[model samples]
Target: MNQNVRNHRFRKGIAGLGALATAAAGLFVGTAGATADTTEPVDPQLAVYVEVNSNDLANVADYTLAESGEAAIDMAMIFAANINYDGEKAYLHFNERVTETLENAQTQIRPVQAKGTKVLLSVLGNHQGAGFANFSSFEEADAFAAQLEDAVDTYGLDGIDFDDEWTEYGANGTPQPNAQSFGWLATALRDRLGPDKIISLYAIGPTYTTTDFSLFDAAGVLDYAWNPYYPTYDAPTVPGLDDRGRLGAAAIDLSNTSAATAADFAERTVADGYGVYVAYNLTATDQSAYLSGITEALKGESTVYRAAPGDTTPPTVTIKSGAKYTKGDAEDGYKRISFGLHDEGQIDRLYVNGVLKDLTDDRWSDLNFVKSGAFGAVKGENTLQVLDVAGNTTEVSFVLTK
Candidate 1:
């Protein structure tokens, strides 16, 4: 199916009437019931990669503690593929250290996994520099896979990701290799790991468009592939052309190149029936902006939804402020009830007593509700509710004494 058509259909399927209501109201809607109205339908095709180093992993436990049961994030991928053979003992190699770094990372990661976060351990498989080299041959590749398999088995890893960029030297400093080699390695790894485990690859940039993908059994072996989509200044030019001539060559300069291009690539890959993982550099917020674009693209679709790294279920609502009111104060009669709501996905509407109010725009952070309405206590109970972008609702109640 065409990407535009597929996206349209998916949007229709998930959004339905709830999104229309949000668009019409221009405010967040809340519900007493569990199911609330959402602005955009959930996009199952959407996934995010949280690249963590030893330093980042060390603080992961503390970082997650502040979430307070409201945030829903999924699938955190740790860098360097470090795993311990045993609790204290770690397997360290020259290419990448699996020693103390891995021990510390695993120590932090265990709690996250126990709390139901999907952990993806990424490793450099026969890469060019500072790692195992020359897995071009099948025998060499098999040995590398065996090592990886052992590491995975020992650590109880959820999945393994391959970052293989090995190839013969090319004229333009690009790797030139027969694509079949990669396919063979992927197939072998899948067979060894069995069906339940996820086998993903970090795909190359230029190779994504021109490489022969037939060798790899896309349906059987590969679960997903992530493309960095890093931007390059070099424009498309003829081979053997002078650098000066290439500079003058007319190129397609997209207005919002990052998001627009990334979305285009994601849509194309998804159409090929492959799940797309948008990779972002943690230090660079520009990558985050690119992810925002991808999010917008998915928002137009229905079946594709995004979940936060730690959360599986949707967000719940709580009364962060204005839980109590003092008697005889001027503001006492006019109760300004405030709420704290967090949704990993986008939140569209918030309703109080069936009347929609604008808390804030779509964001992943907590939203504060401060509506000026006649909400005072008459020696009875009061209710507040919050709605998310996926039609999920959470509520809190309080009693007032006069």
Candidate 2:
């Protein structure tokens, strides 16, 4: 996702859960005199992935340990670096601010790891051209994949969250969108890191309809598919995806809604049979309450996480614009995207990039087609998110090359 100024970009721009990955044997064993050793994290269901870039070592406590009491989710997907893959291999580099957090991994991540909360290192995509041009070929990824494995060992990380936000600018992080390569990487990771290690992915727009992720399921490598960047993407309904409902989950961006709204989403997400993942920015909100509210609302289901019901499924939507949003040059003209939504429940609201639409007529089409120009669609990525009265959500994200 291309970032705003206040938030520190992991690399000037960059880029969650499922089945219980077995913690690496002896991986949680503490080094000589480490403070938070032996804390082993449980299989996290209610999770949060936070960015460490904003703190600058300021009063803001590190995210995982910031909460006063027990954590709401069992895992914390922490940002360590922005990744880039050349034609052959993948590489990651951390922002100066994140570098500091990594330095404190022992103090920050270790304890969480020891406490049974999996502390994952989230690696995003590149800002450079072809974002993931490198490492697209599985053969070329041996070394690159090896490096990733080393990272897990060195940092004592549980596993990786491949946020391949392909098709979006700045945040587009796929390694050439090669499904085989992705599956191979996961396979390699399982072999190298341990089968019990968790492997999660981005249930982004393109990935939902494509077979790219099925390879992961065939390999039995995926733990869950976490949705965050896109506001309304429901979990994919793909067969053979063993962990789809168990580890596959959805997330709420705090910046997009209020605590009450977040709670509502979490409730619906939990009710939907899938787990819940929440993405938080350290610099943006009141971290304590944000963490606490979800924790409190999720009472009784902490240990045995809630599973989403078939009835709680979100709506289905499509952007008639086809693929990309912006047609051509900024002067070429705006594209009118005709879209529709369908859910078992009535829609409560519709939002595009965080702004509400005019739906006073009550007819679905009233908010259907959007002229990019009239709706303030930007030159890059644009999203159409629809949430129903029952809390089901569906969203579509497309690129506008203006």
Candidate 3:
């Protein structure tokens, strides 16, 4: 049971106790250091930040490396989350879509992780004065670090990526940006998250202007840092971080960036011995050709588009053979009713009596909810609704005789 779906159900009223039983089944793929069978990540990595607020995170798996047959993008970053101050303290806050993505990590995120592409959540500021550089105390930093570690552990994320922006330091009665706070927080995160877990920086804003070197192990704590601007070549000048840890050229916005410029960025990244190339805001539209410019320049191979265009047809719900209420065969209320849903387009939502009961990305031909008492069938009329990713919907209603 996805938490978002569960929340939806609660707002609409209780759907069933059956949903609670499936809650444990929604396990995250795994944490860092758990990639035992995955392909080793490529060098001179092509990392992309996916805007989950607007696009599907699963889009990260759509591009494949032409030569190695692995994920073309080495890292898939969740574009952002915020550190918000809620009067008393600062805490991590994920927007609705980010929460949905993480809650559905097994379906939305695991496919990319399965391809050996690391998935990281990028944390930034929300103008509430809760940025990374204004922690005020080491304990405050450690407390925030624990929240991040818990999120990683709970969601099976690869690690954290820091993007220092929009913090509005000195607002909301919070301390202004300090030199030691960022280093203290980063150090505490590295200490708690373990060595294999990734810790990256966006290499812009206060993370550069305010971070102090002697307070934190820059080389040891951060795994990668990339320039935040687009179509530019400027490596971050953080002390202790080397060239291989720095990705200094050709950050691009896929929706608007020029391919040739991206190619030049990749060319520079490789020629200058930078360890990573960065792209942002990948969408459902195919960008293999645009991405190939970077891949060909960096890896000497073309990028492959492996995603099939989504099906647009609506899904169907049918009363299966054993459904007594629909057939008018059982006068007494039936505890179990059988039904099947079919969709080549892939069913993404299942609603019962106007409440969301299940959500998934899996395509289905004939999925049945026959067991577990027909997913909490109650006396009187019941309605089942099904929908696909393309927003097509189908609904069926049946009445149990009193």
Candidate 3 weakest lDDT stretch, 10 residues: 27-36
Clashes of each: 25, 27, 0
Q: Which segments of model 2 are wrong by more than 4 Å?
A: 1-44, 56-69, 85-89, 129-136, 166-176, 205-211, 216-219, 230-233, 237-239, 242-244, 247-249, 282-286, 301-402
Candidate 1 per-residue lDDT, tens place, 48-137, comes to 343343135323232221224311223455555521122222232322333343465457567656655555666542222222222246
Which predicted model would earn the best lDDT?
Answer: 3
TM-score on alpha carbons, each prediction: 0.43, 0.55, 0.66
Candidate 1 — which residues are off by over 4 angstroms? Answer: 1-42, 45-54, 58-73, 81-98, 125-137, 166-176, 205-212, 231-277, 283-402
Which candidate achieves the best TM-score against the true structure? Answer: 3
Model 2 agreement with the true structure over 212-253: per-residue lDDT tens digits: 545555437666665543233244433345343433334566
Ranking by TM-score: 3, 2, 1
- Candidate 3 lDDT over 1-402, as tens digits, reads 123211211221221222232234542111111112213333588888877777889988989877667678888888677788998789999888889999999888899999889999888777788889888899999999999999999999999999886778878898888889888898999999999999888875566666786677888888877766654555555566654534444477776678878888888767667777888778888899999998888778888999454456888776666544334434554345556677777778877666666666666535354333355445677777788877898877666543
Among all windows of 10 consecutive residues in model 1, the one with the lowest summed lDDT is: 245-254
lDDT of each: 0.42, 0.52, 0.73
